[model samples]
Target: MGIPALSLSGLYSLKYGDCVRLPSGAEIGYEANVNFRNSYFIPDAVLRTVAGDIIAKEVFPIHLTEFAAFGWAWPEHGNDFMFIWTQETGVVKEVENPDLYNRLSQDLGETYFGASKDMNVNTLWIFNQLKEQGRFNSDHCNTKLLTW
Candidate 1:
């Protein structure tokens, strides 16, 4: 059996910066304020091995209404995975190991333009689907099959 892992979640506003807490009882206090010029605000989560070696880092858009994008980095394997969820079309697309040049322009364009309708509230529903389907399992990451 795989070891239990920590999952962090929280809400942040201008008044209260990142108030997210990890399952281990550690908290991520405020760090920086959001910039309106930027198109996305990515909140991050880290997963470490039992020995304390960082295994993976996950980043996702803080606002569900914005373009649905999630990224995962595995330093051990030198690999990265990116996923974009389109609200309008209800499509989830993957851009494996995207590079700096195409990461935003091309991939994000495909995600945003491919959709036919907006999926504001449904973004959370999709996240629940991933969680329910065991996408957060350590085995999935260990086998390089990160589903979420």
Candidate 2:
């Protein structure tokens, strides 16, 4: 998210599906990039419906809705501030390749989330967004200098 606010913020490559277990046993998802449309992954939700958390609840109903809101599409690695707080406590343990959010969203039964399931759509979105600013090139497709 916010690079863990570490002295070596840009050192580690935090990939999607990369998880850090909190001392309380909760696992938080690390959004590696915006190449894939990611969501707040509930590890134990039925595929038929999702989006019940407060973060989504403020925009979406407690259950499924036709008008689901999307994030700004700013191409951010994305920060979960609550997760960052837990990491700050120094009890977070880095883990590799756990069940990730965007990967699970692909299996959602709702048609409203169809776009998020497609990885290429996000890839193109990032490319176009950067290209408009004259920052994109063939050599920098995977570059992490994505934000202002």
Candidate 3:
């Protein structure tokens, strides 16, 4: 997607800011603010679709596979849970292991990893499905998920 251009007047009307969460869960304030000289227009519906697609992908792991089940059930039930696993850990994308991916996809069904509508809210559903199948350990990292 391209950067959106907003008209000077409309740009001035935009409510640009951020809601920061403190250690005590308190909002701080918004960041830098500025006014643009030109205005670029985009339809609200188009914006919503684009935003929804991004939310879905971000919520759903493109690469999902099945592995050994742990003592617990397949899908773990919790408020923030996304997927369940046994002992597997690492990248969950197809590029990690094509053969394993194919096998898991066959066993679980293609619908397991399709486009989602409300990923932020539905991630729990995906996690539940994974747990039900006795497979969790699945993970996703954009670029190897390097951490300090």
Candidate 4:
């Protein structure tokens, strides 16, 4: 972005004397930013260590495709995130694989479920049901996962 009309040099005056001058810090301002994380794609290592065993038995079938992030959350404060993989914390938006979602939705015909609301429940319920059917047994990534 271009500098705003008023910046360090314009906001303050620096007078140079015969042998004296303003300290280096007093003459300018600098700010820089660098982001290293992607909005999506949690690293594989994090998923295994942070919450794998627990998720395996409790939330099977919904194995993480990749990546993870953790934080404290509360439902009453609207800080609780959905317990399903999402592109951008989306609750009902299309899942990463629409084919998988369609298969699950079709399989669960009339069953009702949700997480915070109906959509997430439906998705989670599908995951459980699919797991029961062994649909995820040959998942490509799972075959390569080295338990940590």
Q: How high is the CA lDDT of each candidate model?
A: 0.30, 0.24, 0.25, 0.23
Please, what are the lDDT tens digits per residue for candidate 4 over residues 1-148?
A: 2253223223321210001111110110111111113222111111112112221212222222222211111232333332332233322212345564444333322322211223322222433343455523221121111111
Model 3 lDDT tens row, 49-117: 111111121233322222311111112232222222212332223444666644543443233231232
The alpha-carbon lDDT assigned to residue 45 of candidate 1 equals 35
| Candidate 1, 24-73: lDDT as tens digits | 22122222232222244332233333233332343332112234333333
What are the models' TM-scores?
A: 0.20, 0.17, 0.21, 0.19
- By lDDT, who's the top model here? 1
For model 3, which pairs clash? 5-40, 6-39, 6-40, 7-39, 74-131, 75-131, 75-132, 84-136, 85-136, 85-137
Pairs that collide in candidate 1 are 88-117
Better of 2 and 4 by lDDT: 2
- Runs in model 3 deviating more than 4 A are 1-57, 61-91, 109-148
**What is the full ranking by lDDT, best candidate first?**
1, 3, 2, 4
Tens digits of per-residue lDDT, candidate 2, 40-80, equal: 32111111111111121111111111222222122124432
With a 3 Å backbone cut-off (N, CA, C), the pairs that clash in candidate 2 are none
Q: Is candidate 1 or candidate 4 better by lDDT?
A: 1
Q: Cα deviation of 134 in candidate 1 (Å)?
A: 24
